[model samples]
Target: MNKFRCLALISATALTLMACNPASDAKPAATIAAPLSATAATPAVTNNSSGKIVVYQAFTRLFGNSNTTNQRFGTAAENGVGKFNDINDAALVALKGMGVSHLWLTGVPHHGLVADYSAFGISADDPDVIKGRAGSPYAVKDYYSVNPDLAVDPAKRLDEFKALITRAHQHGIKVIIDIVPNHVARHYESLGKPTDVRDFGADDNTTLEYSKHNNFYYVPGQAFELPDIPAEFTPLGAEAHPLKDGKFAEMPAKWTGNGARAAKPDFNDWYETVKINYGVKPDGSYDFERLPADYANKNHAAHAAFWQGKELPDSWLKFRDITKFWLEMGVDGFRFDMAEMVPVEFWSFLNSSIKLQSPDALLLAEVYQPQLYRDYVQLGKMDYLYDKVGFYDSLKLLMQGKGTSSEVLAKHAEVADIDQHMLKFLENHDEQRIASPEFAGAAEKGKPAMVVSTLVGKAPTLLYFGQEVGEAGALDAGFGKPSRTSIFDYVGVPAHQGWLNGGKYDGGGLTAEQASLRAFYQQLLKFSSEASALKGEFVSLHPLNLTSPGYSEQQLSFARFDDKQQLLVVSNFAEKPVSFNLQLPADLIKTWQLSAAPVVFTDLFSQHQQSTNPAKQHRLTIELPALGSVVLQRQ
Candidate 1:
């Protein structure tokens, strides 16, 4: 057989072992040829001693974009992209007023884009390879650069982003950007990379398909081919490109980012990117030494010691340098994308270096494996992991009336060991908006869910930008469909723009209903941040009321308390009003040390007061409004 045919035959057979565990399928700007105006690397000084964090996630391209066209597959000029400069002091103050502690600006990295940026020494990205008119932010092109799309000057993009970071800090909000370690754009090139740092694949031996030191796995002797485009899905609204004719010239095709081994990956595959290898062979055996089992209970110092004087994979070292470079730019923390796909050993090395630099550096990750939660947090040194499969998925079901709040109690029990490290969120970029028809189809339905998510544990609370003003994710923004605010397209968010009010940041144009929803979010989040009870021990009233007539399965009531503050949090997920004798268990009464005298409890959320003697009567007849939540504080 010919060399190409022989390679293809062998590559196809190898995919069975390589493809079984692709990290995750769930699935930017500017800058100079050199580093921007910044001092030498210094460890960032963190001010999160209070131990409560409320992160506001904003799609950088769409956050300040006032363009209302929002047409399907619109170009950047047509859609009017938001710049780093667009997020003014007014915006920062407004976000801070909404009880934000951190502003996580998504899509800050320089990724493959459909727009031409060749004037800046950047190569033009083919739209055929891109997922949207604006490309997928996950398919990063350069590790050292920011996306020109988010910059007003493009050349000064890095400086503009730094200024925004400064502005956020001034407003008392820390900043977080994404770090995608699992993959990079198929046409990855780092023009802004340091002179000393070697480019990926610079010294790779491509004759072999797999190697311990190779940055990427190879389909030797085969040229890369583009996935066939479907009739319904057109690149850049059917716009033509010189490089869009189903051909890309990689001498030895690298394994696809999602682990597809074919020269031409399926259209659904992550074909725009190439996966990074971290010493895992084609047969799924580790080529690098594994950390000891006892390392799971060890701290970052111990983990760091394990890697000292040890030779590591090139990909691991390269990613470490990239992360350290960002940290030096005064960026406080990182949100690692698809962290589970990368090996935990690499995370231990990477996160230890991060913590060693800045001990309080927030190393949040997108890790879905419940079985591997403790491993990632305790051993991998991750500060927080996305609680999607547990709380988020359950909340969605509860909102749809298909599930009960009992799941909340069950999940807390299941993840109690890692409770503090499981970050709770409702509307992030990857999930559908609560107002979307695919979800609850109503914004108010999110109220109860938000209340519980924020106070469930000592975990951080997260909110998407438009989620406050009830921005329904129904926009037809190019490659990404409705139900999610598109991270891959240039589009204006309608409701968020209403709050932006043409960059006034005054919420001048918001409807009364929208205003109320945003107000509710502000109050709840503010309470969560300041409340001492949220950091206290959790006691789910679920088990005590399992047989009570007043406690429906849709209802959940719990108490979080310490000596200084005690809070009774109750939520009714039902559509109709429900009355129940809210039961407090004897263990809770003794744990909290209830007094025999009548204790007046006032609802912080609704300001409704109730006087009940808990010592004499352990249960109180309480009436909960339809689809509502109340936070009662002892008076």
Candidate 2:
């Protein structure tokens, strides 16, 4: 045999060993399997009323930039920045075609950056406090303005953003933007605030360490000091800018975004932002009225009623107004950053206010603490919370060949009660790409994981911009390092640009492999968005198949069904081909009410077919290729 064939045979053997021996050091391959047999088949469900929610998150500044000059610490001028105009109708249509119901335009708000925009009445940011040349999106410099860098004309930035919103709406897609309620940039200034509104901390008592009326927490008589810089690093990489001075001006230094109270925060602290005071005293006691125990079961309208005629902190009211401002400006929802750090009571008040304005506004939060999931969802009135720590983390282990499918099922069962409210995602701005060296090392490895993530839950799925095209995020762009696409720099995403194809919004430049990957994502996302069974019940088949012949720990099996549609979903994580007789449990067989006659199953992706007798065998034989997945619909 040739060398390539020999290598393939060796790889197949190693994968078989890894799957058979759970403790083996061999790398696991990727594939998936699930089986169901039914003679009396129900017709495929066509109800599309309650479709699955698929969110497409795109970093607005980086989404449209086609520049390939990935210069480390490069200036925006050197490496071009994507603007609001870049996301035209063609881009929105492309996103919509991929089953995107909501498009989250990250980094739309005006934030503090090191660039000089003084000509447009905007103050230049000090590089000492900025995380990157493009600035951190969480560090809001203004609450009522758009990022000038995102607009062709800096003065008409808001108008351009409004145009983008209109275009997205025309394509039946809602717009979501980031809302960092926990903190703001060190130099918070609202040049576009209404005439009646005052900037944050404008009316604060600077000497007091804690006050309900104060917008920020103070360190009392201390001046702000920059964190100790490493010897190899300098502000703006020692670039020739006047504002690159290694000093920031802030008297009576406020607490850092991470709640570091020191005048000089640690280098790793969120030093770019200052924490907002939300009526929580320095002793960690609440200064505002706490909600009643029964209020947790109440709806958003009732929660809004509970807050009526009650006193609230100034910061809470300010954030409420900020969300209301966005809602009135045609924004459909918000992605709250570091939501757990803020008080749950504040979320109750703020989210209720948002619901009152736009009843269907999507309220997605970034909360990692599993213990606080129900509190943030029920009392805080959030629509969805990130399923990162539990579901995403466990699946990541499985993809890395460190765990079994059993762990994934256990984690899913743990959150089964609130599974509908937990949003599922494999990639986001905060995560490493599946194609990166630090992650799965290949985009194909994510296929089985993606199948499981989509079929295992009744929650929304998030797809980061370049995730479909397999962007490795290996560029060393300025302040942002490899493995994650930089949210803090002006850089191009090569794979996405290949699909962008210089404003045509076509995958003209994509290689065959990349194009194939994109096609898989497109088909899967469309199926996820339209399938009615995905919105219904789910039952795991992993436990029953654990001891069955040919079934390995690397494979997962499950069933999703309702009155209209029945789906047998399976995924293989092994690198080698796997053939197994997948059994159906008695309960599931009774649920489907199958007869003794032969039942046929059809593959949704490949259009393959198989059959088995429900009463005689109670199982179907399934064969899956390397890194393969199958969604078999009973017919």
Candidate 3:
């Protein structure tokens, strides 16, 4: 079901249930027992060069917008869109205190917005083709400019965005921007494009179905037609739109973004965009030469060397120039949208060229196919890929009380070979909120999951802007729906907006429960970022403690060891207390090379101590509260 309509049904069901049992709407005392404001002060934050890497994903336009009008399908004038000037020194300092190492500023690049910029010599995007009044961030209209909606002065948008990058670096956090190379808006025009660079379709021959040099595929003797709108859908929801008619102007219609070759695409298809040609023929054959098998093991420099003398396609060079332009502008890296749709060879060329310019530039891709994971990382030179098909989906099932904790271990084991290259995240722009009714239905349920996801591996961790504050995505955005945050419209996030606290960047007006939840997230993120043992070898303790007393299927246990210290982590996902004898495997002790000695173990999180004589057998009795996480360190 569409997320927006699905939320309407959810809302009706909730209202009915509330009416049926009025008393059930009251908050449970157990979960609502936090102080009205956070009592304990956070520790001082410093730049730790060797800490666990963390990425904070913030929607560029929503981060500093304090407007609460929240008009559905609201215009910029009504809702007051956040500008690049809003993210000031206070914002970066707050993010640094949360242990953020990287800042992913989504929707920073210039895209199709409904606002009229005709004064700046920019054409207005048609409402029939745009997703919302603000438009989808993926529909790139100009590759070399920043979104004017995010700047204090529309003429100085690019300069304002660069200043934000500089501000992020001052707080010891790197920056990442989106690079949507798979497609472009149907009316792609680069008004601010470089003088030497040509537009996407400048030289394309529209007469042929497929050509080695053509930038797009065209259907001869056909005119572009709008998709059939559903009976219930409206362009602006009872508001007048000047360009809402079902007509667009494109002679010899090109293929849709999703490879739909028909002149008229389905409403469900990505009809607002057109696919970019990457030398792949209509029969799914590659015209460009594939990289050698040995290139998989070679560094990016070697890969760059192999492509130096080759005659690359026009699309390939254009994208390379686009990425290079951003890299030069101080964007630390990129998150490629729908990366798998484009050929891996093009990525090999693009990424290698990227590394040739800046070796430390991060490259993350959204690739769902498991079979192509290694190919994309190894041959495509991608630094990380989303773990949605396995780890994320499995965790969601467990959170909804439909699966066991052992399945999480199994999911990790399945991706053991590529675990270091698979980034883990509890929430992002694409997923439902943990506190939403469609997911776990409570923010507290995400505690154990977040603990494991952050400390489970060497890969980087990600936290969406409002996740720590338990922002339930329940508002009805114009085109996007509830459950997941609206990437298509202009709206303010309630929980995160509270954290903004009217530009103070503190939780000034949050309820007791929210304060406590934010505190929990703060402690967990800080601990994960500073722990030394988390960067070393890991072994699953769950396999050895399954049969122990008081152990259940809702418990997960693991150990990480390095040369100087060893850490034992145990998390309880159930609603009841658990007391169990967690046994350290004989093999684990032998691997640690410990002689017959009494090891003193200290709980880093709870400040409890225990001494276990492992001369004969290695075991310790552990007590964990409901939804608890224990991190014990042995020195």
The lDDT values for all models are: 0.79, 0.81, 0.77
Worst 10 residues of 2 by lDDT: 1-10
Model 3 whole-model lDDT (C-alpha atoms)? 0.77
Q: For each candidate in turn, give its C-alpha RMSD to the true structure in angstroms.
A: 7.3, 10.4, 10.2
- Name the TM-score of candidate 3: 0.91
Regions of candidate 1 where Cα sits further than 4 Å from its true position: 1-51, 614-618
Stretches of model 3 off by over 4 angstroms after superposition: 1-48, 231-235, 594-596, 613-616
Quick one: how many clashes does candidate 2 have?
14
Better of 1 and 3 by lDDT: 1
Candidate 2 lDDT tens digits, 1-635:
00000011112111111112111111112110101111111111122345588999999989989888977667778888999999988898888888889999999999988788899999878888887678888899999999999999999999999999999999999999999997899989999998988999999999998888999999899999998866333436645777666788889999877667888876656778888888877766678887765666777788889989987899998998899899999999999986866777888899888987887888899776666677677777788899987788899999989989999888888878778878899998878899998889899999999999987888788999899999998887756667888877778899999998887788998999999999999889888888888878999999989878778989999999988889999999999899988888889888888778877889989989888766555688888898899999888
Model 2 residue runs over 4 Å out of place are: 1-49, 231-235
lDDT of 2: 0.81
What is candidate 1's local distance difference test score? 0.79
How would you encode candidate 3's per-residue C-alpha lDDT over 1-635 as one tens digit per residue?
12210111111111111111111111110100011111111111122555577888999888888888888888888876888878888988888887888899899878887788888888888877787778878889899898999988888888999899999999888999999887798889998789999989889999987787788888889998988865334437666667767688889998877666889977766677887887777766567777775676777778788888888778999999999899999998999987876777888889989987987787888876665667777778888888877788888888788888789889888877777678899998878899999989888889888988888886778899989989998887666677877877788888888888878888886878888888888877877677767667889999778989799778888988777668888888887789988888888888877667777788867789986667547678889988887878886
Q: Each candidate's TM vs. the true structure?
A: 0.92, 0.92, 0.91
Q: Which candidate is the best by lDDT?
A: 2
